[model samples]
Target: MREQPPYLRVADALQQRITSGEWSPGDRLPSRAQLAHEFDVGDNVVRRAQELLITQGALEGRTGSGTYVAEVRPRLTMVRARSREERGGSPFKGDMASLGKHGSWDSRTEAKVPAPADIAARLGIAEGDLCVCTRYEFLADGKPVQLTTSWEPYDLTAGTIVVLPEGGPLAGAGVVDRMASIGITVSRAIEAPEPCHVTDEEAALLGVARGALATTIRRTYFSDDGRAVETADIVIPVALGEIVYEVPINL
Candidate 1:
């Protein structure tokens, strides 16, 4: 029987030690030479072992500092693609509530922003159409967990109290509710989830390392009459929280 590689054996041993609480999260690992001596392996073997653990996300190397155990953080749950007829409450807040954590968010809205071509297409509008765009940073226990940028045709909301999303009486009321307040019924929405990588700015906001795994959920809402009323892109960290959807199963 051939034996496993020495480095893999060392990594497995270290994994067990870490999981067994012999070393806690954020605890610096021993020097490569020290580990090699303890494991009765060469320096190269210990380096290979450490590199493997870093790639597996079980360990991290800090510049000018030694490698340490990675700290695991809780991920926020994302519930997308709900039927618009359903109440348009904040799903992020609901997720936080379910986890016994307080949820809040900050938003900035800009009016008369010309829609970019891609966004305009999603909203079924012409390119450069005037629109109201709002960016939201969702937080759980005051920590930013997700980000969203939503675009709505200004024509659908012009002269309405809800024209400025997050600025009117219905501020932060959510897409369906805001549209409903103006006699528009958003009946359904389409959401597509795509795998993504974290941007530097998103990484800073989400408090995750740059290049971390992420997921982008793109959603578009349509009025009962088939008019596209709103669209948004939501970004979530893959490592932090889970993205859960409540889809009905057909028997």
Candidate 2:
């Protein structure tokens, strides 16, 4: 077998130090030059190893300060279920409440935005069709945990109180209930989850490194009459949370 890369070896050694309690959370690591001398490798190798550990959430770099062992945070458990809508509130809020964390989100909505081809396809609309687009950053205890971009055909809710998803009397009522208010019942939603790397924009919002491993869920809600009403792309950083699918089995 090929020998492990020098950087990987160094990273393993550094990680062992943390796991063995030699270095505790918030404890600053040795300088790269010092580590390189101790490991008998180039400083570049030590830098790479530290970068790897930073991406893995084992270490963190502070501006003007040295690298340190990162404080371990419990991963948030996000439960996905068809019944979440029936529970009559934001599913994300419920998930956070289960863990005793405060759930909140910041959103920006743009009206009459032209849908791109891919988003159009997901909403079963033609490219260039007007849509209401909203970007959301979900937070747990004021820290971003998830991101979502939602699109819906402008005509579907035009001139209706539900047109602005985050505005009006039904503000934050959620898609399912909001649609129902407009005489359109959302029958089901289909979600396709896939592994993805964080984009620059996602990285900024999620406070993670670009190219970090994440999960993307492509979700489309459909009406009982078989019409696609809304579609959203949900992004969750793997280091911060986990996705759990709960399917009810009827007896």
Candidate 3:
């Protein structure tokens, strides 16, 4: 195997400390110059390491301020199509409770008009077909973390448990889990990841500066027979949250 890069080694060192509980959440880390000197590497190398940690949800950096450890832990439990696993049981779990109590929701609202061509294509519906759309902004510790819009066919979603008037059922339970309860298991999830800039409208909703770096994850859920049922577009602040996957090599 190839040797790991210097920056990656640096990231691994920091990751070990975070995982070991040596560096608790909300803790400040060393400055770039300080870390560079400690690791005997250039500042660029240290910066790269920091970037990796941020992407992994291990660290977060304020624009003018210094870097800090993120309070949110990584998810450990395995999630299947039809199971409700408790996230509190794991050390680095992604519990819905982690979203924070003070984190507010502006109340989910339905889409007034037809979805755009792109969204319609993903939902497997016509461009002008009416679709049920709900927009939500998720926050952590009073800071906007994610902006998402979930879409489904109007006929299938209208007045259903999936579209509750207030505090929608899709709030904390997640769409996948809730669907499983209704006998609609998401056997497969297809995600497309791409870099995106915070639009003016999105920035206002997410309470972030315009042009901030973000990751757009368009996820499509399918049943065991490969029938697509729902589509969700999630925009996450690159500096705050991370998308993690735990893949087992031996299936």
Candidate 4:
């Protein structure tokens, strides 16, 4: 068997210390130089180990201070159920409310963006077709929770009252209702969730270490005519929450 990498080995050792209660939550760690000397490893190796721990929520780094054990917080529970969407409004905010946490999201929309090959295929539009892209940062109780990038073909909603997802009179209304307003009935939605590593931008926004484990969901809403009306990629950090899909079985 291949030996564990130096950094990983150090990370495991540090994790063991935390789990064994040698280091309690909120206890600041020794300086990187001290840890390097103690572990007989280079400073870079210790730094990498510390970063790995930070990403796992075992430790947190304070700006200009030092690394400390992270205070435990209840993991968020995110649910994906058909019933939630049927109820209308923002399912995310409702879900958070159900858990007694406030939910809010910040969104920025870019219009007339040329679709990339991948997005074009998903939306069944020609490559370079104009699209409206909206990026969202979702927060729970003012803490970053997830990131989403949504895309809609420009021609689909152009010259309509709901052109901008978060604008117009129907602002903040969900996709199902928004499409219904334009006489398009959204029949179904398909989602593909996959495990991934957090990118630098995602890490910065989610307040986790780079390369942290995460889940990315590629979701698309389809109309009754089998046309894809909207697609979004949502990224959720593993350390922050767990995702649950609730399916209702007809008895």
TM-score of every prediction relative to native: 0.70, 0.75, 0.56, 0.75
What is the alpha-carbon lDDT for the whole of candidate 1? 0.82
TM-score rank, highest first?
A: 4, 2, 1, 3
Give the per-residue lDDT of model 2 (tens digit) for 44-82: 999899878877778866544778887766788788987
Q: Tens digits of per-residue lDDT for model 1 on 197-237?
A: 97757765665666779889898989989999999999988
Error of 3 at 119 (Å): 1.4
Q: Write the per-residue lDDT of candidate 4 for residues 146-237, one digit (tens) a residue.
A: 99999999999999999999999888788899989999999999999999998967876776777889999999999999999999999998
Cα-based lDDT at residue 200, candidate 3: 56
Name model 3 segments beyond 4 Å from true: 1-104, 111-113, 165-172
lDDT of each: 0.82, 0.89, 0.67, 0.89
Give model 4's clash tally: 0
RMSD each, Å = 7.8, 5.6, 11.5, 5.3
* lDDT value, residue 113 of candidate 1: 96
lDDT of 3 by residue, 1-251 (tens): 99999999999999998989999988999889999999999999998898777655577666457778876533222222212333212111243344333444444767445878987888777887777677777654455667778776666556667654234545456555656656776677787878998775775455444566888889787777776677888887565566665554656
Model 3 residue 107 distance off true place after TM-score fit, in angstroms: 3.7
